[model samples]
Target: MCSFKLRPSKLSRYFCENLKIMQFKNTAEFAKKLDAQDKLASYKDEFIFPVINEKEVIYFTGNSLGLQPKRSQKYVNEIMNDWGGLAVEGHFKAEKPWWDYHERLAAPLAKVVGAKPEEVTVMNTLTVNLHLLMVSFYRPSAKRFKIICEEKAFPSDQYMLASQVRFHGFNPEEAIVEVKKRDGENHWHLEDILKTIEEVGDELALVLIGGVNYYNGQVFDIRTITEAGQKQGAFVGWDLAHAAGNIKLQLHNWGVDFAAWCSYKYMNSGPGNASGIFVNEKYLDRKDIPRFEGWWGTKKETRFLMEPEFEPMPNAEAWQISNAPVLSMAPYLASLSLFDEVNMDLLIEKSKLLTAYLEFVLHEIDVELGETTIFEIITPKDRGCQLSVFLHGQGKALFDYLMKNGVITDWREPNVIRLAPTPFYNSFEEMYRFGQILKQGILEN
Candidate 1:
């Protein structure tokens, strides 16, 4: 029951106009109507989707790398223009003030992740920020040193945690606990995670989990888990790379001790653009907490005084070890402006329906193919736009088929494909056509 229309999508390079008010069918016509009804439908034009063989391909890998915003070029150009015209003076003389460029993004980013502006700041890459935060929060004692995380967290996180534990002189096999789903299960059960935390009791010093599992698209109940971990005297934090902009968050209110995320995936801030971090207000004022310090992290009033002593800022900005990379941050500033306008609530609403419709279409495909269905969906109902499709046996060939046929989906090792119907620029009609192409791929295979 996904019906939309296709009336000149006022934002991108998509076709099919004068095709509105149609029924929800398996036909291309139904897909077009669904596109027309989308309030965010027009915004698709603002992005640049890749064209394969002179035809536009259906791009569905937003969970990996998002499409570039048309305005990204303009934003970068403005910075280049300032650099060209003003040279070193641009640091203080530019229209937006490059000296404090990173500060400008704090407010907008706060709105995106649901935190006070002072509690959020753009900083290093995901794992780098994770290491920085762990320095302060991961103070392990002899009686309490175990850190709990999911089994298949992104490789970078796994390495960082293992190293952090090793740096503390603890055996990783005993210090790091990776909670896993039951055998033959696709998604993780929340109760199982809570039980693990409870069993660890006071021995659990920290709980570091991915807000959304990268491979299986399982969205964890962050608030509940944080509460459970805290009840056992564990400091809780989240690796939110896949969850940041894809799902609504309240990191501050959830009492999360700390969290970090990259902006490229869901935030659409170009590859390796910058990462954001959140630290609760309580930790911001405590001088007792240990952290690495740099010139930028010192208070603005004394930052230029060249004083011998280090004085940290009163917020998450204290975590910054260096000045902002203005050029790298330009694309993010451009994208954050868009987030400011549309907001998370509206974007998440469209994402829910769009992904559900995709699930519906895939189930229909499963019914037609009987036991030889294309793939089984591993993502659960609590997910964002991403759906991790677990294919049957060496599915790389099927992945190649989809790619060659103008469908862009993310392929993971073993036998899984990740597809995300991002509300920012993806259409329901694209989902319908993707289903059509998938059906054809299955028939040919």
Candidate 2:
């Protein structure tokens, strides 16, 4: 048995408690034994995997794009069939009416992100939804025009924030305050984030950050940061592209003003699927809020009445500018069905142990290599399943070797590889196999 120091969380506690009594072995038989005992072992069959060299590739890129659910085709086919048979009547005649198809995902997505059903809605893509959320939340005045965010956030987020400040007639360099990581540190410290928010003080109008960083896979303290920013009289929101289905969130309980996430990642929807947004209940049905209106966002009673006055929906759907993309949302709904079967609590529990096992296997491979470890896992313990490993004394040749040998991983510029072993489809056996493949790749290179 080994003592693992993980970030403080309910899931981490569970992982540590189990680790204290169980020994981790770096053998194929041990991996199979663990998989045999896995409750979600059958879930691997639910997703479609790419095969290379006559074997299913070990996928470790769920942080970027999740594997497609096998049922997704059925969902998409239903939409296609409805569109073909009913034509214009599909809006109301179809089994799942096209008009309110997006509504099907609201409840399940709310559970995954820890929000009220009314607080969540499926709509535009990730960046688009963030921009829309900023329209209502990022209110800037002469005295309160500054925004605080993590340094080197996902490039799309950086662009959105910059464009937002500029749209409000403020220079980005002066209005945007980025909380920088300490020298030689891979992750941001919570104290630094709160301190920056405090220092910005009255000038801070908005605090928008990624709940989980894309590069380092660090999970930010969303609740604490939201409270700190709001205490300073600033609106706080999150871009949950990497956090939504990967980590546990309590958006409503945390009192976050607004947030958005893409379903294509950990939610296991197809690539570039529709995004989901969360709006605090306090902000819902408010006539005072600034928003871009559309017919789809109006109240259902008057949506077809052709009224000149815009009557917004009483929930988060009020932020929607147009009709839902049912084709894109079909797969998302399909993926949510799987989530409905396995709640976030169970998924998170499995994630903690699976990621810990992956970490253990990585270390085992490092020990087998030499006295000096050639890998440095940049992702901190305050993370979900993603482990961003920096390869020292190894280059793209190793990455290429892994790809050629049927390992699907995400490669970042310089020399880092992000591996996310999703709780649903990814198995403990794959983690052990990855470690062996990695060692062989290094040796061969």
Q: Tell me, by lDDT, which candidate is best.
A: 2
Candidate 2, residue 2: Cα displacement in angstroms equals 13
* TM-scores, each model vs. reference: 0.93, 0.97
Lowest lDDT 10-mer window, candidate 2?
6-15
Local distance difference test values of all predictions, in order? 0.86, 0.91
For candidate 1, list the clashing residue pairs, or say none: 4-33, 4-34, 5-33, 5-34, 5-36, 5-37, 11-45, 12-45
**Model 1 — which ten-residue stretch has the worst lDDT?**
7-16
Q: What C-alpha lDDT does candidate 2 achieve relative to the native structure?
A: 0.91
Show pairs that collide, candidate 2: none
Cα lDDT tens digits for candidate 1, 138-252: 9999999999999988999999999999999999999998888999998889999999999999999999999999988888999999999999999999999999899989998
Roughly what TM-score does model 2 have, to 2 decimal places? 0.97
* Candidate 2 lDDT over residue span 270-344, tens digit each: 988899999999999988999988989999888888999999899999998898899999999999999999999
